[model samples]
Target: MLGPKIREIREQLGLSQKQLAGEDMTRSYISLIEKGRAVPSQRMLKIIAKRLNTPMEYFLGESTATDTDIGEAVLDKAKLYYKERNDRACIRMAHNVLTLTKDVLDQTEAYLLIMRSYNRLGEYRQALDNGEAAAFIVTRTGDRERIVQYYLEMGRAAFHSELFHAARKFYEQAYTYSSRLKYLQDEHIRALIYLGTTHLRLGNVDQGLEFYLKAEKEARMAGQPELYGEITLGLGKAYYMSEQDGHMQLSYDWTKKSVDSYKLARSESYVLALHNLAVIQLHMGQKKEALPLLGECAGIYDERNLPHKKASILEEISKIYLEERELQQAETVIKEALQLLELRDEGVLRAKLYRLLGLVFHEKDNSDEGYYFLRMSHDLLKRIHAEREADISHQILQLSKQKQKMEYDDYKSYIR
Candidate 1:
């Protein structure tokens, strides 16, 4: 009965023996267990029970056959909803099934899947909330790998929210777990890169550069060019943020290296590298060189149906137009960018777009519009307490006031 049940549940869950095998179990061991040639240990039984969405009692042959039929029905509906990308529905169904069977471990994994779906949908705050809940449950059960993965997902959510410090903390926790386990080398490298990038965002250039370089070397030694590309992009961002003349050149060089590595790996990192290089060129007063790269980035993002990346490229194009003193062109590009913002609900990115729009209007001598958008940006920045963004807002307010006062004085002189 246990052997047939194991095989039945495995097939229903669409999981192969290879997928169910972990550190302590091999595919052959799983096959042996399912064939009734070997009885599983208590822990292994629990693992299989969680994977199959069935209670351990089912395998113990204590449950009535009717229970298996009902459990399979619930699992089938959950699988269908998950396949349809209806994550919330899938989570609800999975939770209800777990309630019926007391399958805490399976419920925890289901919640993680829901959290990932939220992340994919650009619901970072909700994703973080769900991930924290899942992490707590998994950690209490002593599921080390799941705990590590939960922390990594939480870090990604924090990073998206612009909580650089919080993101770094979570990534560090993930790194500790991965290091102690010594088996998840890919995850370890990813944690290192994420931590380094967060440090760069927090203005710790030297430390960030050090971490990025270390990650790059480790990735290369591991023969993982994708990881190498990711770390190089971090290094390039660090150099770009240094805002020093020589560092700008270094930024371009690193960005080029990142692009080359990503291309070799046949990854999406190439698009990101192109965007970063364009930003560097725009800052370096090479608008002509930046525009073509921005166009390429925009096209790639659009092709991939990534509205966030497209919005970012549009904002960069607005900056180039503003720098060139083509105010009308800047305004047009900003409007297009704002349209992209409607597709997703990311407050930080929206705030940034508003700030860029404000700058564009201010350069166009439209003080009223400029001040309005600037104030909107400031309000959003204040909510996040983004100090660097707040500083930029403050500068914009000061300039707006100065420009207004100058216009008033000129009007008075004309009346005299």
Candidate 2:
């Protein structure tokens, strides 16, 4: 009878066992109580009541109830299905609870869990649909903190889909909610970081930098070194993308700081910091200095199974060879990079590789082949609307034309 009442109240509020647990207990433990196989401890009962916005006595059938006395066996089965990540089964069980009780919270929690499963499976639209429904229900119930988290989830989905503006909008809404709640310090920081990254993606560099700096200051004040390291990394990247030699050096300095902080914390954040530092060093004509850093980055990416990042580092190695006038070695390295790009199916990276190959051919005095590769790179970059690459491609085209004219003039002079 207690189990049935618990399930009834859970359904009436539309909360899933997992949601009711609220980071206090696992979904499996919640199921045992619902099945009458185990009675909830006093502490557990209080948590569930708080999560369901009900009284603990409600589970004991003390208050006026609006649900049937269904057996606890069905609840046990539902818990089992949930433990297996079977969203369909959970939804079915939630429907049964709904039939016996008009619990909006239970329904909302079931929908949210289903949405999360869909999100994990990459069904972005469906996930957004279900998440939006859950958010609507939560909003109506005035669960401000949960509503903010739901919006953040939606923002993450939008960010994954490359909808930067939409992601920013959602993140802003989440931030507003967090501010109103005033108790979610960590959540506010997370929202700020996402907002900063979104601005960076949208080419609003100054705005991005402002947000990152603000986050860094807040993190420092809060004694959160890890968050400080993260924001510092973002600041370094923003500087690197500025493309000025001075700013590139500044980028290297900031990244070095980030790497040191991360190392102190024994975190994996050093991987990206090292990679970015290598890039800046390469651009500064310190190929020898950059090599060891690139090697470290490659090893980390390899361990993480990030083949595309590994290939990118290989491409940088080829660039160094090209700059050093080692045409044969450059050609070999570029060929390896081409193979990697093919395997990874990375169009943007392949375009970069092609441009580097153009430089290699130009160095070998094969103007025609060099121009052809550069043109190919330019076309691909144009298709992607990569403004920085497009500008570089234009410069390459101008240089190629000048080189061709010089070669023709030399040929005429020799014949004369």
TM-score of each: 0.73, 0.64
lDDT, candidate 1, 1-416, per-residue tens: 67779998898889998887655355776887778765554566778888788988878875443544455467578778878999778767766665554343455556666667677676888888877666645554345566677888889889887777789899998888787345777888888888888776554677788778777777877776777888888888888766556987888898988899899999977899989988888777787798899899989988998887898888777665655567788788878877887875456567777877776666557778878988998788677655555566766677668665223222211110
Off by over 4 Å in 1: 1-93, 100-104, 161-166, 200-210, 399-416
State the local distance difference test value for candidate 2.
0.69
Q: lDDT of all the models against the reference?
A: 0.73, 0.69
Per-residue lDDT of model 2, residues 1-416, tens digit only: 76777788889988887887654455765776678755553445667778878777767665544352341344455556777988677657754654554343444445555555556555667767766656645454334456567777788777655566788898998887776334776777778888888777665677777777777766777766677778788888778766445877777788888887777777877787788778878777787898898998988888987777788888888766655567789889878878866655455677777887777777677879988888988887676544456567667777678765223222211110
Candidate achieving the largest TM-score: 1
**Which segments of model 2 are wrong by more than 4 Å?**
1-142, 243-246, 331-335, 338-351, 361-387, 394-416
lDDT of 1: 0.73
lDDT of 2 at 314: 84
Model 2: how far residue 9 lies from native, Å: 22
